[model samples]
Structures are given as structure tokens and as C-alpha cells.
Target chain A: MRFTSAQRLDDGVLEREFTLGEIPGTLWTPESAAPVPLILMAHNNGLPKADPRLVARARYIAARGYAVATIDAAGCGDRPPSAAAEQARADLRRAMRAGEPLDEIFESLVGPLVEGAVPEWRTTLDALLELPGIGGPVGYSGGWTALGIRLAVVEPRIAAAGFFAGGYVPRAQREEARQVTVPLLFLLQWDDEGNPRQRALDLFDAFGSKEKTLHANLGGHTGTPSFELEDGCRFLDRHLK
Target chain B: MRFTSAQRLDDGVLEREFTLGEIPGTLWTPESAAPVPLILMAHNNGLPKADPRLVARARYIAARGYAVATIDAAGCGDRPPSAAAEQARADLRRAMRAGEPLDEIFESLVGPLVEGAVPEWRTTLDALLELPGIGGPVGYSGGWTALGIRLAVVEPRIAAAGFFAGGYVPRAQREEARQVTVPLLFLLQWDDEGNPRQRALDLFDAFGSKEKTLHANLGGHTGTPSFELEDGCRFLDRHLK
Candidate 1:
């Protein structure tokens, strides 16, 4: 791990950019010197780690006294693009334009992305935990929902998870949801234009966790109510802090 | 309207038992001498206003500086029973015992009950608001959910509502849900044994509120997490206070 740059923000949060091997990422920590639990924020597909929404979420949760980190996915942000992923993206666009069924297209696009991103995230998690001022029990939050699900199922360090359910979830991943047992807070936008509502509800049902909660609000893909930020913080506090 | 009994509880909540015409009810108010917003809690079918759960919720919300009130439905609590309602209950039991289709039986049971209860609730609302220390902008919370939908659609005074989606929602009431425009906090027990989870999700979808939220927790009908009480209070405070 190598630190690329660091800046102190007006809100007293320390924002640092780093590179783990080839994976670029950012970390945000509060002013508190005491080690705090960490949150690994997973961005929506195509959203870079530096996207404003992810940055705002990172800052807000860090302000609540937790260290927050997010890393660029396999072919996103400052990283080299994958030829296969670009081909899948073009296929998705063509399928959508032709009003064709998109199950295979989505599977081709998101399946490998998740397959590659999950290990990168776990590896990043490995390095992030080794850093000073960031401590365990970690929480996995936000989209892609599939990544969160995979991590919640396989990552023993993730004590809790909060997922945004507006992203494409591959069919095999939906089946994998039955293996997740950690406490979960799943948020769904009832009117999210880009996501199928039934698929989201079905995924919420498939979670095998004994303490899963789904907070569905009326809104488009980006219209999740702002109050959820604090709510997610409280959930993390209950489980992590 | 007549006050049948009044007692000041140890927690500084003023508990009052009252009757409006043939309807019996209870109200809980904080120690505040000034007026406070009111929450008209609708009890689950057959659970009466004085049910322990209802009392606990009322007192809890009352302590939050809001006056909370609940009243007996047409054939619940100290009120006289209707022979017709008795027949419907018997039919419901027989259908359940035989694994017969229950749509008509549930409709017969809940549809008229809501019809009769909505007007009684409105009349009680009139009398309660007229009383000192109980102010405008009432919130309707809890079940029978059909009654809440009816009251929310027909009563203009209710500013917000929090619904428990464990009760059987008559098909007609599901249709009426689209007309309820107030901000809503809908709670669903994802594994509620007595309630169909898909129906609850569908009803939540049909609600027309521009600002509706569904909070689905993993539990049976009676297992809503305790933090939801405070969550609901904050929701009401957002619109009612």
C-alpha cells in the first residue's frame, strides 16, 4: 500500500488517497485519534470511488467517528479498462436499444465484474485493516448490491452490511443471497427507474440473515431520502461500535 | 364524549379513559400543559385500545411530547359485539381449519369493520382535538391497516401515518391505498406468519404518497424491532410537530 496524497478538510475529516497494488482508493477518517471501526463503501457499477455521492457518504459516516474507505472496481476510475467488460457494455447498450431481453447481457457484464471486484475488495480490506487508525469489525455498505451480498456471505470480518438495491444483481448472486447471515440493512428505491422492483423485493426475501431489514422509499434511482445516511450510521453504531 | 376515568402515570403521562357515544377509548398525554400533536393509534383487529401493546406504544409516544389516543372498534373492547361480526369470525376460523380460500371471508370481516371504524375514529378525533392540550395535525399509526387507509383517505386532519402491514388488507382497502397522499411510514414483518408478505409489498407499492417508506424487518408478526418506535416518532415529528 502506498499513500498518494492527503488533505485535511474543513470538517476536520482527514481524506487520503492511496493505491493498493493496481487498485486506487480513498480513505476518510474523523479527527478522533482513537482507532475506529471501518466501513468499506462499495460504489454502484460504473461509479468511481471518487464519485460525489460516494465521497459525501464517506465524509458523513466518517464524521460519525468511523473510518471509511472505497476502492475503484476492476475497470472503473483511473484503472485500465478491460476489453471484455467494454464489449459487454456495448452489448448491453445494443440490447437496450433494440428492446431485447437483457438477462444474458446483464449477466455477461456484471458477473465477471463482481467475480473480479470481490477479491480485489477482500484484498483491499486486508490492507486497509493493516493500516493504523482503522480497526475491525468492518461494515460493507452501499451498491453494487451483488458485491455487498458476496462480501457479507464470504467475508467473516463484515459484522454488518447496508446495501443500496438499485443495481443489477446477477441470477447466481441472487441464489447466493441465501447464504448471507450477518445483520443487514437493505435500502430500495420504490421507483428506481433502472432497477426492477420485483427483483429487489425478491432479493430482500432471499437473504438468509436473521436480522435483515429493508428500507424502501418512494423515489427514483438517486432519490433515496437523505435521512437514510443517519439511519445507516446508527445501524453501524449498533453492530460495529 | 365523556371522560370515564383519569390517572396520572408514574412517568408523568396523563392516562384518560373516555367514551364517545357507544365507543370506549383511552388517551395518553405528556405532562406538558401546552398543546401537543396527537397520534391516533389504531389497534390491530380484536386487540382493543387497552391492549398492552397499544398502551405501551401510546405511553411511549406520549412521553415523546405527543398526545396519543386509541378507541375500541365496533365490536372490540368494552363495546357490545355484533352477531354479524361473530358469524364472520366463525367463518374465518372454519375456513382456516379447512384450508379454504379466505378472500371473501376476510373481506366480510375487515371491510365493514373498517367502514364502521373509520367514522367512529373521525368522530373521536373531533372530540379529542376539541379537548385541551390535544392539538391539530394528527398522525394515524398501527393497525387494523384497512382502517388506517380509510381514515387517511377520508380524514383531512391526519398529517402522517405509520402502518403495520401484518393485518389482512381487504382487496378493496388495497385499492383505497392509492388515494392516501399523506407521508407514510409502513412497517412490514417479512416473515409474518399470519400475513402474506407479497400482499404487504404490493399494498406498499400501491400507496400513492409522494413520500412513503416501507421498513421491512425480518421477524414474525409480533417481532418488529424496538428501535422502530423511536424511528416512527422521528417520522411523525418530521411532519406533525
Candidate 2:
């Protein structure tokens, strides 16, 4: 994973969009002379690193004094949506939502998606750490996909994570979670239209982190409530600070 | 994993529904004099070990001179559906079907499911091997869940494996597949309603097995065609015989 270029977004923040080979991503770091904590913010499934919500969150987190990075998910962001795959994914998700049984299709879509995303995340983390002042207390925040859950298990650099609603727990990775001791702030939307509530509960139940907390609010899958997001900031603060 | 009880089915197959502690499972073995190969058969999502289709497959495989075992999934069979969790899983799967973007939820579901399952399978395999004539070469057969994909990666005793299409490839588990050199016979239903074709393709692509074969049939997520089943049996015969 190599950084292609870095640009000064403004006086307070530096923004760099890079290609670790084919994978595209954007990194935002506070323009500080001293090293700061880094937050690897992952976009929700289907959303890109440049999505406004992510951009806003990155800015918000960066303003709070941290290096924030968001990468284009597989087939998202600067990358072209995989041909035929994007439509097939949409159709599969639609059928699943229509109360039809599409577990197989869901598995097919999600399994490889996670496989593709996790490696890129690790690579991005490796690259981020190499940059000056982009080190110390690394963390991750993402929605529904809980990609960080796997990261927490595999990436020792991840000291804390904030996982939001929208993802189900895979059976195999459930066991891996048992090895994750990272402090975690898990957010859940009560009426998440994209995920089941129990999956969150199950994942929370499976987490080996003695410091994990579940923050649930009354809403669908969307931008997390401010209070919950604050709770997350505090959680990351406790660990990353 | 412990044996609760053993019953002799009149059909020359000894049926034993045992508990590897809390996990419930049933093991069926041919009432033969010689030690035989064992086939770990898993039901598709939401189906129990006793599901007739699985039973029929188990019986057919047993009649081919092998012992067969099927365990109830986390919420399946005798395990009371995990209390309030089943509905959540249903909704999650629904949202995924609707294409609402629940990759994280899918990961949550599939990760834990595999985490919970891989151990159960290992335990079950251990117990099955303890029984008379249930030793020698071991194999696995299952549907979209493809629970044994991890077993293939982790379990060296697995001489060969037949993974039916419909399950997604977990991101964390993908690298594990590269370690699986087990002779593999991957079965795919051409138009599997539950899984996308690409998922199967990706998994097939990820597998490191030089001796792997893809047996695809044209149909929704239904029964495998006879010819494909026969081809799978032959594949098994080559490894397990």
C-alpha cells in the first residue's frame, strides 16, 4: 500500500486520496506539528469514502484532533462498480427485503465483499501509520458491516472501534471476535431496516472485549443519533486518548 | 461433545442424537462390520438436522458405505431458536433480500455462525471418529451456508469436501481457503435463489485446491440434479475411497 499524493485541503487539515495499487482512498489528518491519534473510518456498505456523511464525520473527527481516513469500499468510491455485480447485488437485496429467502444470495454478496474489504483496510492502516504524525492509538468506526470487528480480531493496531448498525454477524468470524480485546463502542439503530436487531446483540454477546458497550437508539439505518455518536466519540476518546 | 443416547434405526443405520455439551446433533452410521468413511452433512439455513431432505442425503451417503452426521445450527433443531433472536435473523435476511445494504449484518450473521459452527464440527468429527467404523477418510457436504469452508481450512483430517452453492465467502475466512488443498467438489445450482452466482465463482476462485471441480446445474435454490449429485459422489469416491 503506497500513497500516491497528498494535498492541503485547507489550513487546518491535509487531505490525501491515494491508490494502494487499484484500491482508492482518502486520508484526512489534522495539520498539527505533533503526532495524533488515527481513526480509520469505514463507509457503510455501498457508500464510498467520499460520501458526505463520511466526509462530515471525517471532518468532525479531524476537528476533534485526529488523523481520519476513509477508503472506497469494494466497487465503491473512485472505483467503478463491478459490472453486472452491482445490479445482481441490488436485485438480491431487493428480493431479500421483499420477505423472500435469499440467504444464499446475501451470503454470496456479503462474503466476498467482506473478504475484499478487510485486506484493503489492513493495507490502508499500514500505509497510514507510515505517514508522519499519523501514528498513535489507531481506531476504526463503521456502520452495519462491522468490518472493524474482524479488524479488531486480526489487526493488533486497532486499539478501539465504534461499530454501528446495518451488519449481521457471520458465524465463522463470531469465534474470531472472542479473541478481540479492543475497547469497542457498538451502536445499533432499533429499527434498522437493513439488519436484524439480534445480530447486533449476538455480536455484542460474542465480543471478547470486556470493555465493549452497546449503544442502541430508536431509528432506522441512517446517520447515528448525535447522543449515540457522542457516546462513540467518548468511547474512542477513552481508548485512543 | 457427549453422547446423550443411541438408537438403532431398523434400516441398518444407527441413529444417535447427542449433545457435545450444549450443541445438539444426530449421527447416523451404517451397521457394518468394517470401519467406514464419515461424511459430515449440514442442512441449509433454518433447516434442522432432521429435515427430510438432509436425512435422505445422509441416508444415501450412508448407503454408499459412509457414516453421516448432521447437527442443528445455532438456532436450529432442538436449540429453541435462540429466544427473540430468530425473528431478528429473519428480518436481517429480509433486509438483505431487499437490497437495502446490510453487508455488516451479513458479516455478523455469517461470522458468528461460522465461529459457532467450526468448533461444533470439529467436536462432532472427533466424536464421530470415536465410534466404530466411523474412522478413516472424512468428508463434508452442505448447502449455501458452506459451514465447512473453515473446516477445510483448519481441519487437516478433512480429506475431501463437497460445498454446495448458496453461501457467501467471509472476508476473514478467504485467506484461510488458500491453505485448503483438500480435494474439493463444489456444487452449484445455476440459478440459486438464495445465493448469487458470483459468490460461488469467487469462492471457487479463492480455493487453492488444484484438484477442485465446479459442478453447476440450472435451477433455483432447490435440490441438486441427479447427474451433479452423481458427479459429487464420484469426486468423494476418489478421495474417501
Candidate 3:
């Protein structure tokens, strides 16, 4: 069936606003399926809600019969309250009051603008999980947004996570990788020249989970692999299925 | 000192070649210095000898009081022979017959047109190392080319290595990491979607030297920290000094 942003429950396609508490997101799912696995796809840093990468990924996974929800975290994507320096300062103040570190404060504030439409993302994920056909394992991809989802969602329904050039803040959170009982996959480049390689390794090493797998490619920092989607499919299939 | 092509070395601050053997590269050194430590730098794939990135890097390193050399590998950069399908096919055949990789074969066939440019990167390193007053650790950066240098250089003079998004290739020549006995510092990105995180980890883990360290940053692929050169200089100072 054709994939559109509107909600469609019968042909296994649905798009609607989901609310995680007060957080909102845009959800997409297969209408005809029942209790199928769910995937929480987060956008890359600074990507908009309608980013082609996120949209394409959602469509690809949905065609595979899995429910995919793309969320734009706070201040990101289509969320209102544009990312102005003044707004950022206010968000940072709130995070600081919460005892969160500087990076987390920055992440919570500017993350949305750098990720996607945030309100739609939170609303979408919540709505998708409540659907009859959507349940079971949850996976996350993209970068900063994925890390945000990990913080917001603690449901047992999340069975696995896949990071596509995304990671968590406060360094210590990465140390808690083992706590994420689900399988975790990290994709990176060797000749990136942009991103450092050591931190990714440290995170992998700190991951207490035995299901963690890492794959390296020859591409540079903006290079996408030829089989990234297929690889993601296989990983989700193995864990969520 | 001014940097110039091999043909203009006589008139410039430093004269250099892009590669000494089957590799492609550029060489630069202060015309006033009696002799200096030769620094070998590798470029990322698809980058030519004259790429602005390489030029900037070379110029920066040269200004830092080291003799800098940068090279483009085969199949890319300021050297492309015959750009014709039939000629390219013939060139490949000749290289294979000569027991060389395509890059080496192409370098040999197009030596005259490209001015004896080949993938003799290691040979150049050897020549540089042998130069008077060049005694000390050799430093390298870049992606695949850095790895290539690590594989080919057998000299004991290479006291340290600083890798920037350099580790990506699979283990080909029987435990490549075991050969690296010098201090190594690796810089990586936590959210790199391009390179495989595991391969970088494998390389870090394989480093038998006791002085290996890995550092991670929050940036995505190719994310250079606000002070990358400063950090690199610090790392080099700690080890190469």
C-alpha cells in the first residue's frame, strides 16, 4: 500500500500524533497487522521532521511489515517554539535546575531543533504503541534524537536499539549501556576524520549486554553504506521478531 | 615557507612528490631548515593531491615546524590515467601481471604522465626517515591511507601515531594491530553513522602497545571539535615530543 503521513489503520499504515506524557510525536504503523514489533526512529541531529532519510527509513521498514514511528523530540522537527538563543538559555536553565549536566541541558534544549519536529515525534510514538497491531520490541536509530528517546522511554516493550551515528550525553549514560538489556548495534566510519573513534569503543566496551555488535565501514564522515537499510532490517528481524 | 609541486620545489619553500612508490602524495619542507623531521600525512578517498582539505592540512603541519608530505592514493586525486574504459582495463591487466594492486599498476603505467607518481607511499616514508636530521617518531593522519602506512612501514623510527577516523579496513594482513608497538591516540565521534564502530574498537583493542588511548566526541561523522588542531598538537606533543 502507499505510504502517507495521514493515519491509515486498515492497509497497515497509520500516521497520527502520539503523546508521551506531554511529549508529542508523529506515528506510522501497519493497519492490518496485530501485535507486530514497533520501531522508534529518531532523526539525526538538526534534521527536520520530514527529513528524507527519516521518511525513507519509515517507509522502508513499514513495507517490511513493521511499525515505525518517527519522533521529533522537544524543540526539534515540527515542534513549535523555534530554537532561538533565548529559548535555548531558558531550556538550559530548566535542565540545570533538574541537576542535569551541561551537555544534557543542551541536548534537551537544542536537540529538538537539530533533530526534527519534537511535539509530533512524542505524540506519534505514544499513539503508535497504543494501537492494536503495534507492540513488542522497539528500536531506535539516528543520533541525538535516539538518545533522547532512550531517556524518555523506559517501557519493557523496547527490545533493541540501533544507533545510526547517534549517542547519549553525560558520558556516564554510555557507561550504563549494559542496563539496556536489548541488543545494541553501532554503525560508524573509519576515515570519518570528523568524529573521534575512541569514545564509540568505550561505549561498546562498557555495554554489559552480550548482544552488542559493532560494524565498521570504509566510508568517510558523510558516507552512507550501500546496505545500511538491509542491515537494520536484519538486526531488527533478529531481535524484534 | 611556501609549498610547491615537485616541478617547482626549486623555487618554493619546500619541494615534494605526492608519492614515492605506487602511492600519490605531495612533499613540503622549509627551504631554510638544514633538515627536519619528515611528517607523512594521508588523504581520504576521492580526495585529490590538490584538494583544499589536504592543502590546508599540509600547510598547517608544515607551519608547525615539520616537513609535511600528503598523497592521493590510486584511482583518485590529481592522477587519472586514460579515463577511457579500454585503456583502464588494459592498465589493470598490466598491474595484475606485474603482481601489483590496481593502484600500483596504474601508477607504473601512468608514471610519465603523472611524473613517476605511484603508490610508493612507504618508499617515500623510508626516504624521508633516512634524510639527515629526520630522526624521530613519524606522525600520520587521514583515513585508509593512515592504515596503509601502518601496514607498510616496518621501520622502528615511527615512535608514535595519531589517528583521525583512520581505522576501517578489515584485518587483511594477519593481525595488523599487533605490529603497531608505538604510542597511539585515536579520535572518534560517538554518533558517526558512516564508519563501523566495532571495527574501530577492534583496532583500538588490537593495539598491543600500552600507550594507546581513545577519545570520543559528541559530533556526528566528520565532526571536528572546535579545537581539533589544538587537541592534535597536544596529543602529538605528549608522544612525539
Candidate 4:
């Protein structure tokens, strides 16, 4: 991992960018040199790693003595979205619009990307945890629900996680959620259009975590209530810090 | 798995259409009272389970004392092609015309379907293998190569397998091919349009099968040479039965 530069963006948030092979990502941490809990953050499909939503969350988390790391998912940020990725998205959208079962489309685009991303996340985690002033348990906080669930499910290194309601969980990967045993906080947007209420609830029900929480709010997918994030942070603080 | 009916289709070839829940599939066995090696077959994108190419292959294999079976890939054949599958095809065609990488589009549609199909294949295999005369050391011979590679990698039950060159292998899933160790025969069309020559050779090189053979012929993806099929049959006869 080669970190290119570090700049204090906010009063307490220090933004640093780095690379691991072709993967480019940014990290935000408190300016202080004290050891702190680390949270890996991700945004929704329409946003980049530095999307305002994730940046705000990273800032909030970092301000309270936590280190947050995020990397652009393949073709998401600072990288040209491959024509292949674009084509996959178009197919997914067309299929969804046509009312066909979107499981195959979702996985076709996601499975390999997830396969590629999982190792990257683990590698990033390994490199970041080695940095000075970062220590102890780690957690994941992200808006793209399945990426968070999928990551948490496959990589047991995460202590606790909070995933905002977004994408669908393909039937093929649904059983993977049962493999997740860490503390989980699911932020469900009751009126999320991209994901149905039942789907979110069903996924939440499938989690193997004995210590899991679902924070349902009236907003749509993009409108995650602030208090819920706080509650999620408190959950992370309890488990990670 | 329930066997609804078995009908003698063409002299030596007997067709049995069965269902497992909503899944529809077919089996072709030689009209005989003896046990034989079985080959589970899958056709490429241009064909269905009963596509002339696959049906012909099944008939030839069955005539040679091999029971061949195939099912509608989820959202294919008897079932309506999901919008996702259709969209993926369209995207692939457009990308091929535009000289863009088709792997993501292929994977986006195929990956999830493959994931869903794997367990179904296992279930179908379990059910078929239990029937009176159809016995052990099952083999998989299929087009749309990744599904076969993915299956052969994960499911050790397959005794010996052959996969026709079809789709591109993503880097993430490429390593999984290294897990395949059964006696393998890859039938390659030298001038395949959907699958380029180098990709086929590369994937063949990645296979962990120490007993693997690559039978290459001069033709496009659509025009498979006849002599190569006979050679492939001999290969299957040597290892499968």
C-alpha cells in the first residue's frame, strides 16, 4: 500500500489517498495520534468512495476518535468505468424495468466484482491496520447493503457493521448472510425504492448475528435518518472501540 | 426430483422430461437394460437444452452407451429467458461490435445464473444418479465454459469433464479454475467468435487437470468439426465409463 498524500480536510478529519495494485482508495482519520477503532466505509452505486454521504459518515465517525477507510469499488471512483461494467448496468436496469427476476443480472455484475473487491478490502484492512495510531477491532459501514453484508459475511475480520438499505441480495448469495456472525446494524429505509421493505427485513432476519439491530426509518433509500447513523455509531463504538 | 414421463424420441435415444419444483429438465438415455456412464450437458447461448447442436451431441453420446442429461438453465429453455439474460446478450453483441470487453456483461448475466444453477445441477445429479440403471462417476460436458469450470472446481463429484470454449473468464474467477483436478478434455473451436482463440488456450492452461487434453479444430464457434466430436467421444469413453 503506497499512500500518496495526507491532508487535513476538516477540523478533525485527515484525508489520505493510497493505492494497492490498481485499487485506489481514500482514508479519513482523526488528526490525533491516539489509537482508535477503524471503520471501513462504502457508498451506494450512484456515488463514489468520496461521495458526500460516505464522506459525512466518515467525518462523523473520525471526529469521534475512529479511523475510517474506503476504497473505490472497481470502476467506481478515480477509475474509468469499463464498458463491460456499463453494459452490465444497462442489462440490470433493462431487466429490472422489464420485471424479470434480476438475480442473475445482479450477480453477473456483482459476483466477480465482489470476488475482486473482497481481497482488496482485506488487503486494504491489513495495510491500514498496520499504520500508526490505528488499532484494535474493526467494523464496516456502508450504504450499498449487500457489499457490506457480503464483505462482512465472507471476511470475518469485521467486528460489527452497519449497512444502509440499498441493493438486492441475489438468491445465490442469500445463504451467505447466514454465515455472518458479527454484531450488525442494518439501517432500513422503509420507502426504499431500489430495495423492497420485505427484502430488507428478510435479509435482516437471515443474519446469523445474535447481536443485530435494524433501524427502520420513513425515508427512501438515499434519506437515511441521522439519528439512526448515530445509533449505528454507538453500536460500532460499543463493539469496535 | 420427479420423473413425469419418459418417451423414446429417436430409435436409440430416449427422452425423459422431469421437474424439480418449477425447474424443467430432460434426460436422454440409450434404450437399454444396462448401466452406463452419464454425461450432464449444457448448450451455449445460441441454443437451448434441446438445441439441435446439444441434442445431436446427446444422441451421439447416448448411442455410444452414455446417458446424457440437461436442464433449462434458470430463465432459459422451457422457462422464459429473463430480461436480464436477453439484455446481457444484447449488451454482448453491442460490445463485440464496438470492440469492448464483454466479460462483465457475460458474467453479470451468467454468474448469478451459474451460482443458482450449480446447486440445481447437484440436486438434479443426485436425483438422476439414483435411478435404477444410471450409475456413478458422473461427468459434465458443456458449452458456456465458465459454468462447467465453476462446477468442476467446486463439485468434486464430477469424475471427468469436457467443456467447449464459450465465455471469457474474469481474473477473479480465473484462480478457481486452478482448483479443477479431474480428467478433463476441452473441445475448442479454433476460430470461435464468441470466445477468442487466445482466451480458450489461456483457460486451458489454467486448468489443474493433469490429464487434460485440448482438441482444437479449424472452424468458428458455430461450425464445429465432426472428427473432433468423435475424438471427444473417445476421450469421454476412456475416462467416464
Q: Write the per-residue lDDT of candidate 2 for residues A1-241, one digit (tens) a residue.
A: 5567877665477777778878888888887888999998886667777788778778777867789888887787688888655975887878976877665666666667777788988888887888889767898887634577777778888888887763465555666777878877667765577678667667666677755555544457773555444445666777888
Write out the backbone clash pairs for model 4: A108-B107, A108-B108, A109-B108
Which scores greater on DockQ, model 1 or model 3?
A: 1
Error of 3 at A143 (Å): 2.6
Report lDDT (Cα) of residue A212, candidate 2. Answer: 59
Compared with the real two-chain complex, what DockQ does model 3 have? 0.03
**A55-118 per-residue lDDT for model 4 (tens digits):** 8888888888889998988878887787877788899889978888887888788776666677
True contacts kept of each: 1.00, 0.00, 0.00, 0.00
Question: Rounded to one decimal, what is candidate 3's iRMSD?
Answer: 8.6
For each candidate, what TM-score against the reference? 0.95, 0.48, 0.43, 0.49
Looking at candidate 1 chain B, the ten consecutive residues that score lowest on lDDT are: B165-174
Off by over 4 Å in 2: A1-11, B1-241
| Model 4 ranges with Cα > 4 A deviation | A1-241
What would the per-residue lDDT of candidate 1 be over residues B1-241, giving only the tens digit for each residue?
8999999998999999988888898989998877999999988776677788889988999999999989988878888887898899899889988988888899889888888888888889989989988877799988678889989999999889999974478887888889999999999898887778888888888888999999989989889899899889989988988
Taking the tens digit of each residue's C-alpha lDDT, what string does model 2 give over B1-241?
5778887766777777788877798877877888888888887656788888788777777777788888887887788677535765777778877977655666666677777788888887887788767767889887733577788878888889888774465666765776778877677665666677667656766778766655444456775554445455666777898
Interface RMSD of each: 0.4, 21.9, 8.6, 26.8
DockQ of 4: 0.01
Ranking by lDDT: 1, 4, 2, 3
Every model: Cα RMSD to truth: 1.8, 22.3, 18.6, 22.4
Q: After superposition, how far is residue B125 of candidate 3 from its true place, in Å?
A: 34
Model 4 lDDT tens row, B29-108: 88777788888887764356878888888888888888889888877888877887788878978998999988788778
